[model samples]
Target: MSISSRSDKKGGFRRVRFIILAISVFYLAFLQSSVMTFNTAYVVLSNETSSPLFNQYQLGATAALLNMNQFDWSPTYLPLALHRFPLDGLQRSFTFAASFAGGLLGTFPMLYVLKHVGAHVTMSIVGIASCILCALTPVTIAASFELFVGFLAAPIFPVIGTVIEDWAPMEEKGLFVAILSAHVELDTLFTPPVGSLIAEKVNWPTVFYVQALVCAFFTVGWMYFYRDDPGEHFMITRDEVDMIHRGKTKDHLMSPPYRAIFTSLSIWAVFISAIGTIFVGQFMDVFSPQYFTSVLGYSPTITGTLTIIPTIALLPLKAIAGIASDKITRISELAKLRIFNSLACFLGAAFFVVIILVPPSTNSAAATALIMMPFILLAFLSGGFHKAAVMISRQHSSFVYSIVHIFSMLALICSTFTIPLLTPEETFEQWRIVFIIFIAVLTISNIFFIIFVKAEPAEWAHVSNTNEFVQLTEEPRPKHQLRQ
Candidate 1:
C-alpha cells in the first residue's frame, strides 16, 4: 500500500500508547506559556491615582511605573540590586527578556542533557521546578524562578525531536510532528480564556496555585508514562513499535557532528525559519495581551475571550495541513516542504498586513477577525519548518531542532526587548511598526528556507541507505548524499 493510503488509515494514532504519549506532550505544552502574562498585565497597570479605571488592586500604591508615554525611571540609576522590580510593564518586560536569555544560554547544555540523559528525566525536572516557581510567582517580584524555568523549558523542541524520531513512521513523519507540536501548544490556546476566567471569578494568585497542581500531576504522570525508548513502555505493543520503526533504524551517536550541522545551509535555514516563526509566536502568546489591553482597550475577560478565538481555530487547521502534507505523495519531500513553508509564511504575512490596515475600531468583531487571521495561519507551520527540522536531519533531529529552540529563545529575548521599547505608548500606530517588522522578517526567512532547505538527510550525517531500519554511524559525507 502507498504512504497516502496508510496515512488515511490513521497510521500513528491507531496505536493506544502513542495516544497516551501525545496527551503527555499536550499537557507539557500547556505549562509552556504562563497565564500570568495575560491575566496579570492589566492588574499590574492598575492604580488608584494614575489609572483609576484599571485599578483592581487592594493596595493604594503598587501601580505600574510604566505609563502612557515612557518608562518612569525613578530613583538613581544605581548598579545596586533592588529587592523587587517595579510593578511596571517595562521592568516586567526586562525580567521576561532575562528569562529568555537564561533559556538561550541554557539551550546547548540542556540539549546535551536531553540527548544524553533522556527527555523523560529533563521534563520531570522541569515539572517539579515549575511547580515551585508557579507557586512563588504571585509573591516574588524578581523573575529568578522564571529564569530557571526558562532554562529547563529550553529542551522542549529537542524533546519533540526525540518523539518524532522514536515513534513516528518515516512517511508519516509530518503528521506525527504536526500533531505532537500542536499538542504542545494546547496551553497557549486555552490559557487566554481559562486564565481570564480564573483571574476574574477567583483571583490571579490562584492561577499560579492551579498551575502548580498541574505541574505536580504532569511530573508524576510523565515519569510513569514516558520512556526514553518506546520498547521500555509497558503498554506499547510490539506490532505498533514495528510500525513506528518501519523504514527507520535505532542508532545512537556518542557525539553530534558539530562542524557539519553548523555549516550546513539547510540547518541555517531551519534556524532562520525558527526566528521568523518565533517572532510571530512571541507576539501572539506573550505581547498580544499588552496589545489587546493597552492598544485595543479591552478588559482582561474580553482579551482572553478574543485571543482564544484564533487559537481555537488553529488546531484543526494545523491537523488538516499535516494530513494534507502526508496524503499528497506526488510531491517530493523537499517540494512539499517548500510549498507548505511558503504557504505558511505568505498566508501569515498577508493576514498581518490586513490587520495593520484595518486597525481597531468600535466594531469589536471586525477588529477581532482582522487580528486573529495571522495567528490562525500559525497552523500552516505543521507542514513547514516543524517537519522540515526532522526530515532534513533525521536522527540528529534532536540536536538540529535544538538549534530551532536556541534561535527561538533568542527571538523571545529580542522580542521582549524590542516590542516593549517600540510600543512605549502602546498605540496602534506603534504596533503597526512592530507587525510590519514581523512581516519583513517572515518574508526574508521564507526566502532563505526556499534557497537552502532540503528534505533528505544531509550527506554528513551518514545514514542515507534507503532500506528499512538501516543503522547509522558517524562518517564523512558521500557524493550521493551531497546537496545537488
Candidate 2:
C-alpha cells in the first residue's frame, strides 16, 4: 500500500478506537453518578462510627481522656465534651498530626498495591477493607481512621485516567476525562443529601452497611468487565490496537518532567484555585447542614431538601463547561482555559466572600437566603472552572491531577479542622475568614496565570507525533508555540 493509504487506514482506526472508549466512558459515567454518591455518603456516615478511619484516633484519644463510653455519647455529646476537654491545641494537633503521618506512610503501600494489582483490584480491596473496618468499629473510632482510607483510595481516579488515556483515542479524551471527573462531582453533589436522609430515619452506621453492599456488587462487576487496555479487551480489533500503538508515540507513560511541569505558572494557578474552591466546597460537604442549623436555624429536613440545590446547579454546569471546552479547541489550550477558569473562580469566590461577611446576628431566614445565592453561584462556577483545568492539561491529566489533588486535599484537611477551631461552634464569623483567605490566594493565582501561561505547547515540550509514531523534538520555537 502507498504511504498515504496507510496513513488513512491508521486515522480510520483511531476514530474507531475513540468511539469505543467514549461509549465505555459514558457507561461508567452513568454508573459512577449513582455509586459515587453512595460511596461518599457512607464515608461521612462512617465518621460517626466507633472506629471511623480518619478521625477515629482522635476520638479514641479524647474518649480515653474523658473516660467516656463510645456508645453512651451522642454525636452532640462528643463535640460538647471535646470543647470542655482542655488543651485544645495539643489535642487537635495530635489528631491532625497522626492522620497526616498515617497518610504519608500509607501512600507508598497504596501506590504499591495499585501498581501491582491494578485499579479495579486495588479499589475492591480498599472498599472491602473500609466496609469491614466500619462494621467492626464504633462510629467515633471509625471517623478517625476513615481519613487514612480516603488517602489510600485517592489514587483510584488517577489510575482510571491512565487507563482511559492508554485505551482511548485523541478525539474522545476530553469526554472520557469529563466522565471520570463526573464521578467526583456526583459524589460531592448527591451524597450529603442522602446521608442526611439516612441520619433522619436511622442511625449513621447503616450508611456504611448499605455502601458496603453496593461496593461489593461493583467489585464483582469491575473484575468481570474492566479490561486494563484496548489490547486486552475483546471489543477492540487488532487493527485498532495497532493504530493506537502508532498514534501514541509515548506509548507507556513516564513520570512527567517535574521541573518544567511544576515551574509552569499555570500549574500553580490551578492548584491555588482548586484549594480555594475546596474550602467552600468542604463546608457544603461536611458542615453546610451544621451551618444551616446553627447559623440559620433551619431544621435538618429543611436543610437536607434545600442543600441539594447548589449541587443540582453544579451537575449541568460541569457537563456544559466540559462540552464547551471540547467544542472550542480540538486540542486544549492551557492559557485560554486558565483565563476562563480564573474568571469563573473569581466570580464564585467573590460571591462566597460576600455571604461570609454578613453579620453574625443576621436573621435566620435572611441569612439563609443571602448565603444560598452565593452557595449556588460558587458551586456552579467552581465545578465549571475545575473541568476546564483538566481540559487544559489534557496530555498530562493523570500526573497533573494527582499532584494538584494531593496539595489541594492536604490544604482541605487543614481547613476542615481549622474553621471549627477558630469559630465558636454556634457562630459563622470564623468560616467567613476562611473564605476570605481562600479567595485572596486564588486571586493571586489568577494573576500568575494571566501573566505566565501561554496558549500553546512550549518549546521544551514533548510532542507525540501520530504520523511518525515517535516523539518529535524539534528546534526551540517561541514560548508556548505549537507546530502547525
Candidate 3:
C-alpha cells in the first residue's frame, strides 16, 4: 500500500478501535448498574413481601420445602403484590448481606481468571454468566441460592482497570480512569428508576429478563471487538500499533511484585479508603430506598426518583475532577491525588452530618437536596486515589484494583450485617447511628490516605539495568505531538 493509503487506513482503524472501546466501557457500566439494580430491587421486593410472607406462613420452614417456582412465581406477581405486602427492614438487610457475602466469595476466583485468561475473555464470560444468573433471580427459592448466583457474577466491576490499562493512552489515563470509575455513578443514574419502574409496572422477573438480554447483546459485541493489546487486533494498522506503543517502555505483561505490593503503605491507603467509601456507598444502595419509603413516607416511585438527583449531580462533577487531575501538570501526581481524595472524603463526611441533622420528618425536597449535595461533592473528589492506583502499578493495575475491590466487598458485607444489627427497629435514631459510623469511617480513612498514599511507582515495580521494564519517570507526549 502507498504511504497515504496506509495512513488513511490507520486513522480509520484507530477510530473504529476507539469506538469499540467506548462502547465496551459503557456496556461494563451498564452491567455494573444492572447488578446493583438487581440487588436493590431484590432488597426492595424482600422488604415489600417479608411481612405478608411471614404473616401467612412459616417462611423459614416453607422456604426450605418449596421449589424454585413454587411460591407464586411470575413476572406479574411482584408488581401486583408491591402494595399488598408490608415492609420488613430486618429481612431486607439479611438479603443484602447474603448478596454481598456472595460477592466477597467470588472476588479471588475473579482475580485468578483475569490473570490467566485476560480481561476481555473474563469479562465476556462474566457477562454471559451474569445474564443467566439474573434470569434465574425471580425464581430463586432460597436466599442462599440467590447469594451463590450473585457470587458467580461478582467479578464484573474490578476488570475495568485491566481494560483501561490496556486501551487508554498514558497522557489520557486519568481521564479514562475517571470515566470508567464514573460507570458506578452512571449505573446509579439510570438503574434505580428503570429497575423501580419495571418492578412496579411490568413485574420483577421481567426486569431481570430485560437485563439478561442487554447483557447478552453487549457480551457478544465485546467478544467480537475487544483485543487485549493493539497488536493483537487484526484491524489495527502498523502506525496505530506504533502510536499506542510509543511512550511505552514497560512490559505490562510481567508478573507483579507481590511482596512489594503487599507491603506498600500507599496501596494500603488506597485499600482502606476504598473500603470506607464503598461501604458508605453500598449502605445507601441497599438501604436508601427503604429509608425513603419507610422513614420519609415517600412512595416507591418517588423514592427512586429522589435518588436520581445525587446520581445526576455526580456525572459532571466527576468528569471535572478527572480532567483537572490530568491537566494540573505542575503539582506532583501524588499530591494531586491526596488533595482530591482527602477533600472528597472530608466533604462527604460533612454531608453525612448534614443528613443526620435533617429530621426524617423534614420536607422531602430539603431532605433529598441535603443527601444529594454530599454525593455531588464526593463524586468530584473521590476518584483521584483510583487514578493514583493505576500510576503506581501500570502493569498490575488490574491486580491492584482487585485488592481494592476485595476490601470494598468486605465493607459491603460488613454493612449488610451491621446495618441490621444497628437498625433493628429501623427508626430514625438507628439510622442516625449508621450515619455517625459512616462519618467516622470516612474521616479516618481520608486521614490515612493523606498521611500515607504515594503516587510514585513502588521501587519493586521498576526494571533493573538488566531488564526491559518501563521507566516510571518518563513523561508521555501527546499522540499528535509524537508523530510530528
Candidate 4:
C-alpha cells in the first residue's frame, strides 16, 4: 500500500501508537542515560584495572619526574614506560572525539532511513542494534567502540522531532522540546549510581547487558504499541485528535523560510548559546566519574551516585526556563532572557575554575562540594539557554540545531585531544591546567553569544507566514533536505 494510504487507513491505531511512542521515548531517554553512564564508569574502572599504564602511575610518575629530561614526548615512537601502546593515551583521547565525530557523520544515514523506511522503523533498528552492541561487547575497551553506535543513534532526535511536529501544532514545539528534556532528567538522574554499582561489583560489562535488556523490552513495546504520527494511531481520543489537528491548522500553514531563519541574528545567538553549554556538559559527561574517583579520591560508588545531583536539578529548571522563554518572547525582553541565561553559563564555568584554584590542603569534602557546585549551576543554566534556543529555533530549527550540534561536537573533539596532549600525564596538576583552560573556553564561548546573538519578536513565524518557509521547503539545499 502507498504511504499515505497506510497513514489514512490506520488513523485509530496510529493514535494508540503515538501515546505509546511518547512514553517509550521518555523511557528510552532513561536507557540512554544508563548506557552512557555505564560506558563512562566502565572505562574508568577497566582502565584502572586492565591498563598497565594506570597501574604503574606511581612508578612511572616518580621515574619520569626523577629522570625528567630523559623522557620522550615524541609521537614517532611509543614510550618505553607504558606496557600497552605508548599511544594508548592518545588512542583513548581520540576515541572519545572519534565517537562523537562518528555520530555526527552517521546522522546522514539515520536521517535517510527516517525519511525512506520511516521514523519508527529507523529508530527501532538503531535502538535494537545499540542494545545488542551494549550487551555483547567485550571489556570496556571494546565497548567504547559502541560509542559510535550511540553517535549513530543521535539522528533519532530529528526523526522524533518530525513525528512530534506532525502530532503537535507548530506553536507548541517549545512544549514538545521541553517534554523531551524530561527524558534527559531520567537518564541523568538514574544512571549514575546504578551504573556505578554495576561497575563496582559485577564489572562494567554488565551495564551494557542491562541496557540491552531494557532496549529489548522497549523495542518490543514500541513495535507493538507506537505509530509514526497521531494520524496513524488508534489510541488517540477524539478530543486529542481535534487538539492536535487544530494546532497543525493554526500554525501549520506558517512554516518558516530557511534562508530568512538561516540569516537571522537570533538564530546565531541560539546556536552559539547552545554550543557554550554543550562544551561544559560534555566535559561533565565524559570525565565526571573519573575526575571524582581519580582526582578527588572518592570511591566509584560515591562518584556515580553524586553525578546525578545536577541532572536532578535540571528537571525543575527545564520546566521553568521553558515557560520563561515563552514569556520573554518580545524583542525588548530578549536581551534580559539571553543575558540571564548566558550569565548562568559564565558563573558555572567560573565556579569550575574556582575548584581548580582551591589549594590541595583543602578538605576533600570542600573540594567535592566546589566541583559539584559548578555542575549544578551548569545544569540550571542549561535549561534556560536550551529553552531560549528552542523558542528561537522555530525559524530555522533543523539546520540551526544541526549546525549547533556540529560546533559542539567540534569543541568536544578539540577538548578531548588538546587537553590530553597538553597535560601528557594524569597528575592533579595536569587536571588543574585542563580545568583552567576549559573555564576560559566556556567563558569565551558564552561571551561571544552575548555580543552577537539578537532576539527577534517575529523570528519564528517570519518564514512560514511569508513566502520564505514555503520557498525553502520547496527548494531545500541537498545537504539540508530529508533524504528518502
Give a tens-digit lDDT track for model 3, residues 323-399: 78888889888789888887678888998898898885877778767766656677655356788788777667878
Minimum summed lDDT over a 10-residue window in model 1 is located at: 1-10
TM-score of 4: 0.69
For model 1 the TM-score comes to 0.80
TM-score of 3: 0.80
Best by lDDT: 1
lDDT of each: 0.69, 0.52, 0.69, 0.56
Instruction: Enumerate residue pairs that collide in model 3.
Output: 249-470, 250-470
Please give, for residues 1-484, the per-residue lDDT of candidate 1 as tens digits: 1121111111233475556556566656755754233234334223223333224332344333233224332325622111112356766665656567667777889887787788778877877877777777766545566677677667777778887887777767778777877854587655545565565566555666777786677678787878766544556544565567666654544477889888999988888988988887788777777888987788976786676677778888888998888889787888988888888787788888887888687566677677777778878888888888888788888888777877877786778778889999999999999989989988999999999998877776556354444221222234354222
lDDT agreement of model 4 with the native: 0.56
Which scores greater on lDDT, model 2 or model 4? 4
Q: What is the TM-score of each candidate against the true structure?
A: 0.80, 0.68, 0.80, 0.69
Candidate 1 local lDDT, residue 72: 32
Instruction: Supply every candidate's count of residue pairs whose N, Cα or C atoms clash at under 3 angstroms.
Output: 0, 29, 2, 20
Candidate 1 residue runs with Cα over 4 Å from true position:
1-14, 34-91, 136-141, 293-300, 356-367, 464-484
lDDT of 2 by residue, 448-471 (tens): 655655544433243555433421
